[model samples]
Target chain A: MTVPRYTRLIQSLPASVPFVGPEEQERTRGAPFAARLGANENVFGPSPKAIAAMQAETLEIWKYGDPTSFDLRNALAAHMRVQPQNILVGEGIDGLLGYLVRLLISQGDAVVTSDGAYPTFNYHVTGFGGIIHKVPYNGDHEDPAALFAKAKEVEAKLVYLANPDNPMGTWHAGTVIAQALNELPEDCLLLLDEAYVEFAPEGTAAQVDVEDPRIIRMRTFSKAYGMAGARIGYAVGAEGLIRNFDKIRNHFGMNRMAQTGALAALNDQDWLAQTQAKVSQARDRISRIAGDNGLTILPSATNFVAVDCGADGDFARKVLAALVARGIFVRMPFVAPQDRCIRISCGRPEDLDLLAEALPLALAEARK
Target chain B: MTVPRYTRLIQSLPASVPFVGPEEQERTRGAPFAARLGANENVFGPSPKAIAAMQAETLEIWKYGDPTSFDLRNALAAHMRVQPQNILVGEGIDGLLGYLVRLLISQGDAVVTSDGAYPTFNYHVTGFGGIIHKVPYNGDHEDPAALFAKAKEVEAKLVYLANPDNPMGTWHAGTVIAQALNELPEDCLLLLDEAYVEFAPEGTAAQVDVEDPRIIRMRTFSKAYGMAGARIGYAVGAEGLIRNFDKIRNHFGMNRMAQTGALAALNDQDWLAQTQAKVSQARDRISRIAGDNGLTILPSATNFVAVDCGADGDFARKVLAALVARGIFVRMPFVAPQDRCIRISCGRPEDLDLLAEALPLALAEARK
Candidate 1:
């Protein structure tokens, strides 16, 4: 049989999923996860209004979504205080990352990110044949200065930084990021992922001029908005850079329900504020639970807490495995030092009670 | 300010939407289209069970979908009588086409499709920097023999054939396609897009081996399944080729509602049969209306009929514009010969009633 011809870059790339979803884990385990905390998905669920909007759209599912995503983008633009031309919505931040990488990274182009940062971004860079330069997290934070210096040194086309970073759940203040942008290489574009910004403190989102061509900031309904499965996200940037996304994106890729759901979610800021408060309370409970178990919880600005297991990566892995075995799903960082901690998303009181009950047993099992 | 450094290929490409959606036309005209038959979307909508399933999923929209798409793929496999390994589900057939083109087509690589076939497929080919070799439609049909000869002539890596083709709504028999496969170049892969096949007559789908390495077939929930807005589709191919999609696909790209919705729709074959019958009746009604208006309707085996305006491409263009102006949405093919006809999607009786009322007036306006 003649083997099908794949592009040389594609042939060289590994067929891998960046993260195995919690549902997949459940299937493998032959049971549903009790807590469902591993993937950093919000457990508070979407706003009731958003759910209603999506349900309303379910009956009209025959028509393709507006390719321009006009209504959603317009709402987002108004909410962000930017022109609609400054925004480009897509399947998710994951999808937008793929498009951005494809637009900027030709084969052998250099890109930079923290070593243990969002692997999906790394996956996209590598999929597009971009050479990835890894910068280690500075004390669990994505060191924007270090990333910029490296980008300048390597002449990298793109540098990725997730504010209120994942796995670690650490963040830099917006003022710090604003200062760091001055050090960014002249030719480099900053891909600022703010997936967790809604859960972060007020000043965590950088005050960038919408016309600044050097950076694009992406936000998603998947995080604090509680609509990850809906897969709606948008990037705000200079019109020149944002318009380039239209050159390559799947124009009709946005789900109709996603557009409607996100618009409703955006309109319901009361639900958002309420969810944030609930997340804050849950974060405290999780921190206290970790402390009660003699574990140190990393200060988190996002929905998840990373607990220091007081040992190395292996011990943390054992704790994570034990938690999964106990039906409490939690994940951990992949690289060293950071890998000594296991990440847990903030959940409802009952869900976190399951975690609280499981943690001590998991720790004991890991120690044994 | 420094210009954003897009890839050389991206720099050369235009920021174009492959299809201007009906929503966009409504935005421009400041009124919705009365008929809504332009994009081949099923006005009958999805199975009520599918809508209910999606509605049930709306409340649980906080979780990301299973990255593996295990359940949906397995269900599709059972429905198609193939192993789960044979299927690869995606955001839509459009999204899958992008992935397929990206896998096989590197810069300047050769690919073949009929000139008036799916524009989105052609857009993907060009976006990947693939050199396109177009074969004109054979008497409004996608001629597999001509396409195969052209593929052989150009040593094309990919040859696209949409069985029960789009825009023209023309099709060839399964036996004819199977025989044409004999002439297919050994090295070229045939991309059989069966988006409209669910509405095609029996004996239309080619009975190829699921393990066949020379061809891959794609189907969608968008057409007869009435889930276009849900944005779900899948491709069945050799395990070897199917596995490569994992190398570059957005792992979490599939919307959670789409997964549940498609599975529900697939299981409700009774609803599908009813839809097919509705579409068949709609096609007949459209043909009769065309006859009354002194237009000629092509013999259709799909959800839409191509009505010859009986003059030329320009006349068809004028007719389409007149229809749009009369609040009746319809489309025409973009290439010659085929462009002389306007494509009207199967719609509800009330929608076709509006079309019936508008046709004579539109024809009169076009003639003037």
Candidate 2:
């Protein structure tokens, strides 16, 4: 029974999914979700023009997308006011993170991320056999100072932070992050995941010079742009760092429609503005619903809100399960304290109305 | 001056493009191609229905595609007459190859392929630290006997073959492959890339036996279907092997529009039949054109034809260069003997007319 050998690292990996879909849970529960509020996907949807462009491009699905993503890159550079060299587009932050991890972290290389930050990033780092050093979150937000300290102590090659972060829906000012960058270990590179940046305050994102090689910023069309299904995201960094992605990226990996749709989405700022207004309105609705249920909603500059359940992690888990049972699809944080809250994505008025209706019943049921 | 420390493997590898794209070449030459025949893309285009489906899906680009790819997989399974559990849909054949290589080939593991079969497959194995053993082509076709012998000798984990192959436009009959499959080492998996199989002669594709663990058949929408840009491909294998991809794949990587376009493409066998007819016509036209130029055209079942210049590889190189210079983009084999032939993809009548007009001038120039 001799079998083909997998690499040592691959062999060591457990065949596990980072998250299960709400759809799968529903099949088990024997019903559909009353409110699709998990996964942090934009419920506001993409602009009509962006959708039209993607739909139109769909007709040409027989062709491979431009390998260089030339047109999209050119458009993005103009929009960002940076050279195309400053950006590298990929299949969402998840794909880019995997490539980056492969590029910098080999077996036993030191990498640092906040405990219970983005699990997918940790998954990539671990998948490559990098030795992960987890620093605890300072309060509910990812702590820049603690991350820098740990990176220096471990002599880490990479450090990760998510501004306007997930699960907790908390953020740090750009100035705070910039200060941390200045104190980073000379050999350490900071991976700034701004997947939710478009939904954050103006100065939440640092204005670091593109020439600075110490930091790479990741942004996504998945958030406010409501194109999560498109799987389009990009990284902005110095030319030296940016060019490294070509060493291993799937050169023709981008979907044709996504490349075209993203370009169109970027150009339609009016739609983005309109979506932002919807998101704002939805956020208020989520907060009000949580308050009505006597739960506390954390301040959020993200598309999702983390509502504190006024209980322990276990108690909050019960509430989340009850919500799922009651046809409300919601998720909570993985770590304690943070897990004392449940996360909900902003959706349509009707979707929030469903959430508002179910939250009270679910909470009462959970308590019983 | 300090930057993040890169992994040893990253440090060892040079940032190299295995194959330069036509677009990049065009950028260098400062003009677009007159006849885009290189890269073996179907210039005849995909089904009108596929295009229409994609266009319709474009409006929903913001929604991430179903991670399970339920509809597409079920449709593909029915098309292949296999259980959906036995199929794994991916970004494309390229992406799937990369994943399989990563899964099976560890550092220094032996893997095998024809010397010039597909560089991208070899690139994936090498990128994952697998040692590649190349068995030269038997005549101008992939040498099945030699491949089995080499795989056995090296105890290779994977062996890759492209039927009705690219660059050479040749194929091995399904019976020949089924015979070789019997000799593969118990743990050695055969990755049969049947990208061009749809256009190949009947009995060229191995009869689907999804339960066969020894071989995985890869198919793509990019080639005969004309949806290369859509980034859709699928692999059919035993359930165990197919399920393993879920352990590590980006669950949300599928683009919604791509799924729609691919589904529609699969359903429209009428368009597929028409495209095959057009490709056959284009192949005949190309061969006749080559014969008029005192060159021999290789017998081709694939959408592309390989024309032998009846001269050295150097002569073929010059003719290719001349064609590129004149804005008729085409490619040749990378190694000797085969390199004496230039590969031309099937295109529309006008596109082939451009090739016909350009071939003589290019040949004459090359002769000079």
Candidate 3:
């Protein structure tokens, strides 16, 4: 059979999805999930003020959002204590990652990331035909030194790290990351993902100067602001680095309500503090529940907590399946060691109550 | 002076914005426009049902949108009379264009479009280092035969065409485009943009078999559906071609409220028809206004009409400037000949009355 023509690179690549959303699983099961902790989405929801702002802007959806995202950028700059020129907002951190990789990785260029760190970054690099040099995570933490060494060894143009990271819910101190910055390859830039940073402790975020071109920090409203459905996120870096996004981005990809909603979300810091307190309380509840069930709870600096299932990857997989069967949706790390644990996002009390009732029964069923 | 490091390509590229938004212009002038007709946004707004749907969804904004966009896809499939597998929803046609380019065009890969076609597509191609080959429009129309010839000449992997096109508001019969498809280069695929199809004559949109891999049709709620800021669009193509987008798209980019809004928008055909009637009346009024001022209005199948100012591109530029100075936001084409005209979007009567009131004085001032 003859194939329709595609570029050599595209032809060589396999068509694969990065993540199977919980919605797809629900569709297949013909049932809605009892608890949605799989995607790390905020259960507390966006601030009421943000919702009101977005609702007010709904009738104005006929107009395009500001291509520059000026209002949102100015608000973000003020909130982050950085100049507006240093901020670049996009569809989300995911969209920003795609742009960042496109800006740096050329065909055949080398890039580095933790072996299982955000697969979407690797997808972008590979889509551009960039060669990937992955360093395995050291223990549960992403080893920045190993990533830096790999970058220098492969002469990589970019490196990726997630602080208060996903999957394993592990974190490295901001000072440790700052120290690691010194060892980064001279020509390589670090893409520091802080998607969960608002839920992280103070100083857990790196203190790199906004003028430093060697690093760009990404943050999202999806977690702390509880506006995942708004698809708003921003990157902060040196002006020169940030400006490059304009050369390639979809100038109008941003939604207008997202701009309005995100601005209101930023303005209502009281709601954010409330969400943080809720997350903190929920985390404790999750830890207690896991401990009572004889599972080991990993230390978490994120909105989610990872629990070691006291078994291998396959047993953990069984537990995950059982949870899903019992109408609880959760996710796990993809690789070894880390795969022995399941990640549960902090949920509302009702959702957590559902999880608490289901976990013991699911574990017992999985053991059987 | 020492400069911080960047990837070689990043250093080689100039920082440029593809579009300067109306908001930015307003901010610079310290005032908003009296009439918002510049960007072709539908001032009449989305269906009340759609707005209500979005407002109701604001409470659910804490949850990440279904990554698969399952319900919206099902609704769109039913509305488009196509199978679910043949459609891929994205963050407007702009986001879909980026993903399609990533799937087909590689570094140095050739691409073709009309000389003054959509700049966002050109931006994406250049961002990927694709070699651009432009075919000038035959008169004001995007000549299909000319586009096919250019694709063959450059051995391009992709060719772009927008029916009921932007900037000029010209269109070709669907039969003409369908006949031209057979002449496309063996390896090339045609990207048919039907963004304004909702306002166009019934026969203007080409009817193609969804199983045909030679072409893909893009549609958006950002036009006649009056939801530009919703950021929702979809492409219909062969299943194999559509599935390839999964490899590169930001799967979770679809906003939750946007999905609800679009579904509601699609279900409200009566509102759409009412919007179309308003658009037609507005277009007629604009033409009459242009005729009153001794300007020739181009026949339009779009919500906007282009009026030839009976002078050179420079004079048209002055006229646009004078109108903007009078708080009338308007835009013109970038190329020669076409640049002698300015495009105005359909707006409410009062907004058009403001345009009417400003045009004569602006013209006299421009002449002086």
Candidate 4:
């Protein structure tokens, strides 16, 4: 007749996930969306060689994946020009964030991030009973100086900043971010999420030395390498910090096919370059579509663009609802001011054509 | 110049991984082993349909996995004769264990397990700063009464019991376990890990109602389903307990190919039946080989056998070391009494032949 007793921290936490996935939406709607442009996924997909490699490796799925992620780490180290010990290959950046939060954040500990930054990071922070101190976005961009100041004020153990930010699709140059790191509080580690760095302009990656213990950069193959479903991401940090992940990480967690696919994806720089070109072309096409509807598009350095709906958040919500009703799946920012824009991921010509056709009708429906 | 301030718990934990993966060993030896029998992986591999489904899903790698795991959960729910809310599908049993520990065991919280049982579970408990109270095995079998008594004595929040257990390859009947539940301490949850239940005798699965709040049973696709590398496992429990996992789990941590592959694997029970039969045959063959080598084997209900080397812990270690050196990747128990037997995973016919060739030579080298 007795039940499990959860910890105080677990008991106090709300049982809400960070975001509801598109599949859940499709299931509830009893229909699938025509254009899957809401999740900021690279619709151009992974390299042909990566697909073949994963397919080939599928036969070897009987064995557990290498806990060390030796080959992938070495290849990544070679590419990043750092030692293998400085990189930690994990299930994904999301999983890595969870571990990092667990490592540093105890109950009532402070963490700092932008108010409208990655909700997943906030989810992990609050999940561990850490108090999240948020700074509002300065315009459409995350103000690093404000976030750093908040981190210092709150005595936060960690502060998060995403370069080529999500939802708004705006970015700071590598040099701009590199200089901003100086303002970061002493003992407060900066989580520089570069999940969309692959699609950003040249010199967008911060020029920080691998020996700098103040920052950990998270990069994912999901964005530009186009293996979002594979769930492979890495974090580059100081040797000691990276090695500390071995203490609590699910050592044998990576999928075997994913390990091989990501390795192949990393090697095929030509495909990544081609995907970049497609993303650029698609971004331009998306802007044209938005402009035709008399909406201005944000300057995006990521694979997605934010198109202003030329109204308040309430009006934008109606437009978003209409678009979803029309089977054009797109999302907007959770925080206000930015929520007036609808964020759309780069898709193939046909998928965007669906979006292009639906927007005008969706706007008309919203107006009515 | 200040480094990150780690939590007291994180500062205390050593940065040591639980088990060194076989791939790491292969990389170290500069050659792959002839037989990989250490990790309890199914040498027979997953269903042909699972492989094909994963291959098909690989093309959709640009999309993130469904955070809800809706299809997989619904399928598992129907198969297990339970409602969807009563189940929680996770990365694997390992990943689920980590979450379960976090839910119940806070710093200095009491947890109980057999000393020689699963190290990964112990690793998670300790990593979370939970104080583990060890119960010794009664001869070869884990004594349920002792574990229950210990939980009460220590005011333990959780007690772990893996039926048809790893390393020892032993089990009690379902009725035995069901009857033992009455002795479980009040407020203590029994983690009945059924990772090896598919190969066990009839009635080995406990006859507990899904509504029972005292126990949560974990099952995996890694064993009889032969999809270890794909990382899919589920936990069946009371609805309240099951739903609580949503508070902290990585919503999109699962690989997309794994989700589809697992669904296809669950539907094809024929492949599972074939795998169970093959595992049984391989176990018998392993026993025969041990007998021919003038050694005895513990009766096993798992996809592996514990062959008694007719020696002490030191001698068994030598034999295991020799076997690995001889290119046969067999492992042994970490604790005494169980360490007298070397555990060998069920391998293919050709792999067994390699094992047969290597055993005598390894023993000879060990005797030296």
Task: Show where candidate 3 strays beyond 4 Å.
Answer: A1-4, B1-11
Residue range B1-368, candidate 4, lDDT tens digits: 44788888999998788899888888888899999999999989999999999999998999999998999999999999999999898989999999999999999999999989999999999999999999988878888899999999999999999998888999999999998989998789999999999999999999999888889999999998899999889999999999999998998999999999999998999998999999988999999999889999999999999999999998999989988998899889999989999999999998899889889988888899
Q: Candidate 3, which CAPRI tier?
A: medium
Candidate ordering by DockQ (highest first): 4, 1, 2, 3
Root mean square deviation (Cα) for candidate 1? 0.9
> Which RMSD values do the candidates have, in order?
0.9, 1.8, 1.7, 1.0
Residue-level lDDT tens digits of model 2 in A118-142: 8889888888889999988878989
The CAPRI-style docking tier of model 2 reads medium
- Best-to-worst TM-score order: 1, 4, 3, 2
Interface RMSD score of each model: 1.3, 1.9, 2.3, 1.3
Residue-wise C-alpha lDDT for candidate 1, range B1-368, written one tens digit per residue = 45468899999997777989999999899999888999999999999999999999987889998887899999999998999999999999999999999999998999999998999999999999999999988888999999999999999999999989998999988888999999999989999999999998888999999898999999999998999998999999999899999999999998999999999999999999999999999999999999999889999988999999998899999999999999999998999988899999999999999999999998999999
Could you tally the backbone clashes for each prediction? 0, 18, 0, 0
lDDT tens readout by residue for model 4, A303-364: 99999999988888999999998888899988888889889999999999999999999889
* Residue pair clashes in candidate 1: none
- Return the DockQ of model 3: 0.65
Report how far off residue B211 is in candidate 1 (Å). Answer: 1.1
Candidate 2 has a TM-score of 0.97
The most accurate candidate by lDDT is: 1
